[model samples]
Target: MKKLSLLILITVLTFSCGNKKSKSESEPENITQVNPAENYSGTASITQGIATTITEDIYTCDRGRKTDVGEISSTDGKTWIVPAKTHYLNNDFPFATDLHNSCEGLNYDTAEEALANFNAANTITIDNDGETYTAYIFADNYFEMYVNGEPVGKDKVPFTQFNSSVVKFKVKKPFTIAMKLVDWEEHLGVGCEENRGKSFHAGDGGLVAVIKDAQNNIVSSTNDTWKAQTFYTAPIEDLSCVSEEGNYRYSKNCSTEGGQDGANFYALHWETPTDWMATDFDDSNWPNATTFTNKTIGVDNKPAYTNFTSIFDDPEQDAKFIWSTNVILDNEVLLRYTVE
Candidate 1:
């Protein structure tokens, strides 16, 4: 009877041990960290995924493809187009030559009124006590000017009815002049403006400046001597036609010849360096500014430029309309020059 009792005790203990082992295996010690009511069968790593918010900024256009309107991206520029408040004249800088056509709903301060209402004290100062110089500028659409790495002034008009400006600034000689020139877009990244009953017509970009010293002697002008780099190029039916050997963003291999097929065309973009306007920024690798003729840029009909031919189109020390290799296709260009 004692032997039987020993066998029964052993069976009971063995069963108990088996049950305990099974119970321990079924529920892990780490399971207590999970919510009691939750049924998580597996462990998977979690993450905050990339943002998918839709944006039309040409600078960020690489993340999203252009969407269709009449052609792709017609509604895109509204996000990039500065508000009407951008229309106000920078007081010290008046229009040497301004708007030729009436841009409805926008108030234009004429050259006469701006010159008469000019404010001397508020002009931007790179060197407050330095020599005063005048910059005569004409851009196809827009420009932001920098003198020796300081913000001197920007185009009163961001994008629109063509205008030219004269900026008076106090800066020392050997100053680096940097400009961001944008060709206004009807389509954002694709760089096309609607015309000729086609929704995707490509537009051109040009910028010219003549800087004169306080003595009224021309010190510098936009020409092939300037360093130019293109950050935005577009209306490309095929991208293989474009390439960059160093800073030479070549789009010349492609045809700027097509008109209507830009509906689904592609655009190329690059992030502009933050210190691009700084005096010490190294641009020795940048390509020479490609010069464009008045006829090539189609400036004959635009009085803002034509009206000031003596300055911009001067026969003696002419400031060439400079852009990237393909003005018709390159939309946003950065130019740099040093007046030593």
Candidate 2:
């Protein structure tokens, strides 16, 4: 009887130890898994067993092939593309000559608008007062951004159906933000009239940007409150009517010597302020920027942009269009902004 009791006790203890071991083996251990999509647009976060986040960079351009400049990545946590260079001049004599000769070496208010045709650039100085901020910028054709006179970022493509760029920077007290915007034209001076019968052949130009602080507070944005000026205007000569009754009536090569109808297409010539980008420059004379609502065409095509609504938070600020009297005719315009 004593031997049997001892055996029973030993068996019970063994069973209890086995049950504990099984429980320990079956229990789930803390593990983290991250799976990112192939074409990730922005950052994504996930918190599973141990809380983890995964992110990737991706960019797509007109060609659809992954070129070095079109790559969007986050390997070093700072990934961006500089705007591609587009050919704005052709073999045209007077226009091309004047552009290359007169516009060279001039310190344009905006880097993109330095060329006297179809481009505009401007700078804005902000007193961040020791704060961190992020900027969202986009243009019709292309744009490059600078912070404290340092090139921080630029748009990926020179021209597209539509696109935008985002950048972040930290500054103390006072900082400078400069941008170069270009309105690209395929045929130099409005496409040849021979190709298409469209009256308005000139391309449109616009630049809209917004800045926010680390706390997600709005600091600055493109609006009438900003100061703006014109740096370049192009295709000033009006097309002369060579023949009255033919498909080839208009001639872009006609001379503007005689006092003809629409002889002067109202070209604007101005000297760029030497210190326009400086904080102490006087912008009192500069006109307040004129704000125009984005045309219906851009908004209808939703898939072409990323977070269009978020960047353009205000319905009123949506697709803010900046131009002269006409989009095509007044192709180049310089805009300036100062933050107090």
Error of 2 at 50 (Å): 64
**Per-residue alpha-carbon lDDT of candidate 2 for residues 265-312, written as tens digits (9 for 90 to 100):** 222222345555555666676656566665622434432233345555
Candidate 1 C-alpha lDDT tens digits along 14-84: 98987775655675665546331132121211111111223333221222223221122121232222111
- Please state every model's RMSD to the true fold in angstroms: 14.2, 26.3
| CA lDDT of each prediction against the hidden true structure | 0.65, 0.43
TM-score of candidate 1 to 2 decimals: 0.68
Q: Write down the lDDT that model 2 would get.
A: 0.43
TM-score, one value per model: 0.68, 0.49
**Candidate 1: residue 38 Cα off by (Å):** 47
